[model samples]
Target: MSLPLISRAPGSGRRTRRLPLGALFASPYALFLLVVFAVPLGYTVWMSFHRFYFTAPGAEVDAPWVGLSNYRDVFTDPVVQRSFFNIAVFLVINVPLTVLLSLVLASALNSKLPLRSFFRAAYYLPYITASVALVAVWSYLFGTDGLVNHALGGLAPDPSWLVNSSLAMPVVAVFVTWKNLGFFVMLYLAALQSVPGELYESAAVDGAGRVRTFLTVTVPGVRPATTLVTVYAIITGSNLFSEPYLLTGGGGPDHASASPVLVLYQKGIEQAHPDFAAALGVVLVLFVVALSLVARRFTEKKEG
Candidate 1:
């Protein structure tokens, strides 16, 4: 008295499918992304299009609506324009310095040297160090009466390194490149390690000198790392804030070193104009995206 093969259990005509284990595991992160990133990004974009403001009496809830005016003001504002220019200058100075110096350091570290481990640790120390702490040290060193000025031996007659309008951006660029160098070096080191020794051997067999081998083999082999480093440099350089904020107190002398993020903070937090800040943020996002695309275009290897 066994059931036939076509027999079915009661209420078993339809069955629901279970989610894949991988999706189940990933749902938490997906939810977190939705709550933390997606929501905020959407709100910022929405706020950018309105004349949103806090109520006067209670400073609660938003006020009237205006379209595109905030964006218009951001574009026309001289201070915002200057901030963008300052960031451009920083990128031009910082990106190449970061890439070249990190590559050189990685190449040197890749070779046998005394105290190589110690040097590696020492170089990477700045990157893991807190920006506030690093800025504090830099501030002490770059002050008018600081070690740098003292070391100059009256050559520049008590130069103001961090406070000078012309020099502030460059000084920030130098510190930023120094702070970020170790990370990039580590990246290049890892990339260099993956490059086979056979390639170098082949190059040497072809009568290539060390420099020529590096130029032909090493550089070409690490093109992916170069592209990564370029994108990182652009993003970090554009969003720069911590060093300038700590070293020069938000904006450098006459806003010479103010970045978009710094200006956004001033508008949103200090001035209580979140709408304008949102517009500034959107503009900054666009700027970074455009720059990243341009960088990728140049860095990506072209196929013949």
Candidate 2:
């Protein structure tokens, strides 16, 4: 017997499984992270637990598992300690200077000033320029016999800027701030443009001057951007390598300006201690994460 056909509403009775558009769109980036970051990070962690070293193709290798010995050694190493200390000094100088300069420059650029576009481009030129070229120019300008010394004469330091232990890291900090300032200033400019015109008008109505308006309205309005800038500054400051590497000549002058990344390269590639280098890398990642979190929390609290 033929069964009577029953009329069913569309998409009724049977469940229609729809593709997740969000995940579908995000899969490419997910795959990229898996290949680029996650896999390498997992391998680094695995290496950190073993005394691993590179070997010839098809060669039998014995990578003994060393547990936390690498971490212990990293902590005890004096050079590593000095590298961290140097980084701390760099951050102390770099972060504030970068933030202050970026805000000031961004504010100025945002105003109705003559040649605003020219000044903006001029400031941003150093940021987009090659780091090697910039460092070469900086070295020429700051060398003992360079124009700066010639201009200063006897007032120049006895050992010069990059050569002096006390001056080297600070010099690197300044160089980094100057090099990266344009990028940060761009960020601040975006943030500044978003601030409402009414706030400035209100401040003016209340007899607030430019300086007071900046402190009271402009600064507060850019709190979110401040958080972003601070976190970025800390992360970049912690990963400091290029400036010290190039400007200081591979963290030279007795390693006075050696950063953790530079030290990691020296240990891993130069000294063939991949295990120790992995440990240092892990520690540096953790340190940067912690600092970023602390900075975010501090800024968020102030924002609240």
Candidate 3:
């Protein structure tokens, strides 16, 4: 006779419930993730350590091994240095501008106004459009005979917004800010709405004006929203490939506006050097991760 089911010793492992193996069987997706993302990332790391050229595969001779030489070369390369410099310039001008503009616009939209909904839609219209198409429109708008300069009535020369190294990158930043600000503003507006009216009422009774209440009360109240906007800005800003690629068209003249991502693309595609490209990818990851950490540290919360 078989032993009774409850007769097993409780101290033994037999009493513990066994989970269904069917759940573990799961989807092919789990294996796919392990294969696709995990494998590629590992391969990229390995490739970054080696100097791989396409010709190396065809040549029966031993390919030269280069360990971290590509990374060392990137650090010393003037072109690479300038690309980072360009990114710095962009961030210096746009980061604050973007955050501030979004906050101000969001507050304004939260205010009572005529055709408020219509205006919100109008402002957000650019964001929904295709990036490339909007960028094309931006190119024309800032062109010599474009509407903006024409509207200025020759007050400012319509400098080549897409061609000039000094002005082109800044213009890209402004364009990016313009398009992106709407989404951020909506985010802030929602946050603002969530703030209690009682706090504003109490602040008003305490003789605080709109600006004062906003500075002391509203801003402190929306600290989390501020944190969100800031991190979003840094993350989006690092992925500066599309703007540089389309606006400057492969880093512009003399590689003036070569974003890090753009350089990675050029290395892999134009130069056909996957090894160097992988090195750039690793560098790009470090840059993004560093920026994220910096942003997190900057937005560190204090407990009262």
- Best model number under TM-score: 2
Ranking by lDDT: 2, 1, 3
Candidates' C-alpha lDDT: 0.81, 0.83, 0.74
Write the residue-wise lDDT of candidate 1 on 59-153 in tens digits.
66655578898999899988889987987788788878887888899999998899999999999999999999999999999898888888886
Give stretches of model 1 more than 4 Å off.
1-28, 56-62, 112-114, 157-159, 289-304
Model 2 lDDT tens row, 31-146: 99999999989988989999998888999899999999999999999989988888678878887887788899898888789998898899899999988898899898888788
Error of 2 at 76 (Å): 1.9
Best-matching candidate per lDDT: 2
CA lDDT of 212 in candidate 3?
Answer: 97
Worst 10 residues of 1 by lDDT: 1-10
- lDDT tens readout by residue for model 3, 1-304: 1111113234775666677764576657778898988888887788888877666455764446788897887788787788778777777767788778877888888878999999799889988988899878887887767777778885855345667778777887888888877777786787687778999999999999988998987787766666655566555655787788877677785678777777778878787977887887788777677866654554343211
Pairs that clash in candidate 2: none
Tell me which residue pairs clash in candidate 3.
none
Distance from true position, residue 43, model 3, in Å? 1.7
- Ranking 1 against 2 by lDDT, winner: 2
